[model samples]
Target: MSNPLRLVLFDVDGTLVDSQGSIVSAMTASFSALSLDAPSRDAILSIVGLSLPQAMQNLAPQQSVANQTRLVDEYKQAYHAQRLAQGAASSPLYPGARDVLEELHAQPETLLGVATGKSQRGLDALVEAHGLERFFITRQVADHHPSKPHPSMIQAALSETGVAEQHAVMIGDTRFDMDMAAAAGIASIGVSWGYHDVSALNSATAVIEDFAQLSPALAQLWDK
Candidate 1:
């Protein structure tokens, strides 16, 4: 196979799907199961891009490590149950996400990957549900790698896809994504439509307002 001109890694939650509702609801359920109050919506959103344990730790730093571990486990169970109750399609893809991915995937020189905080099981379900499994050739999830802001996920995707750090771009909605890209010595794009405020995306190489802007931005990045 010929070398890819670039590898594009995407974050699943705020970047592709509007999963705030499902996440908030699931976190609420997890807290309730422990007979504790759920964190506020803002608090939940703040940690959306981190792995479960990391997120739970930030949300309840006062809790014992044992309790934090329990919360993480409960959050998974509660999230799964909530997703089942809401039907398997609890979150919808952001408008134009499919089109943008389709267009990029068709570019023979570009490879697609996913570097997300979601577990592999969760990523599998999400991709299958959206029929987007075809677009990605590599997927790095929280189950197998350290959480965002860590370069493990990005580096793993680069290694698996045989794409050098210089030829990869990480697209996400949070500082975690940007920091990860920076740590991996790659570029990052932040989308404004996600849970995080635009100001938080200052670390990004580029911040796009919509999916339509992605193609042009990518083209510019590649040519630079």
Candidate 2:
């Protein structure tokens, strides 16, 4: 019988890149453009894994859709501009992020994919800036699916890669990622260095402190 495929799906923002500084700056600029007070940093971090519209809603739950749409549009522009100006320094990879991804991609039995709340354009720029395109086969993005915690992105990734829920694991730093993976019936692992509260990632199979710890955790999951 053919071997079952093992897939590792990664989240972009907090898990792979430390883009929080830039994210907060862009958001501040976005709100500034509208002459509004931006949500606090903690509030922004809390919504880091959601799609922009959903995030805006969480930030201002009582606001009208048109208002949220305006925020979303302004935020996108501000983020794009910040990225362009920052160039390659926009978002550095988290410590050992490249090493882990490289190590896993080297394993022929393992397939790598990405499920992110980032827009396709944003995700593309991020991967390209870091030369990470070759490591991923299927990339599920907010531009292509509903916001995370909805499971559409993970579901689409699993279907596209022909990897069963049991054979796939999601790696991210947020509870949203965990909830999404759970909603899709896939196991998940969390990273500590992301913007979210790592303690809140109770749904993860394991919470890893570094990339070096990831391989072992993944092995443990596969064994279960």
Against the true structure, candidate 1 has what lDDT?
0.90
> What are the per-residue Cα lDDT tens digits for candidate 1 across 1-224?
66557999999899999999999988998888889989999999999989999999999999999999999988899878866676546888999999999999998999999999999888898888788878999999999888889999988888888888889999999989988999999999999999899999888999999999999999889878
TM-score of 1: 0.96
Against the true structure, candidate 2 has what lDDT? 0.91
Which regions of candidate 2 are displaced past 4 Å?
1-3
The digit string of per-residue lDDT tens for model 2 on 1-224 reads 66579999999899989999988988888788878889999999899989999999999887788888999999999999988998758889988989999899998879999999999999999889999979999999998788889999888888888989999999999999999999999999999989888788989888999899999999999888
For residue 95, model 2's alpha carbon misses the true position, in angstroms, by 1.0
Give all candidates' CA lDDT scores: 0.90, 0.91
> Model 1, residue 71: displacement in angstroms?
0.9
Number of the top candidate by TM-score? 2
Give every collision pair in model 2: none
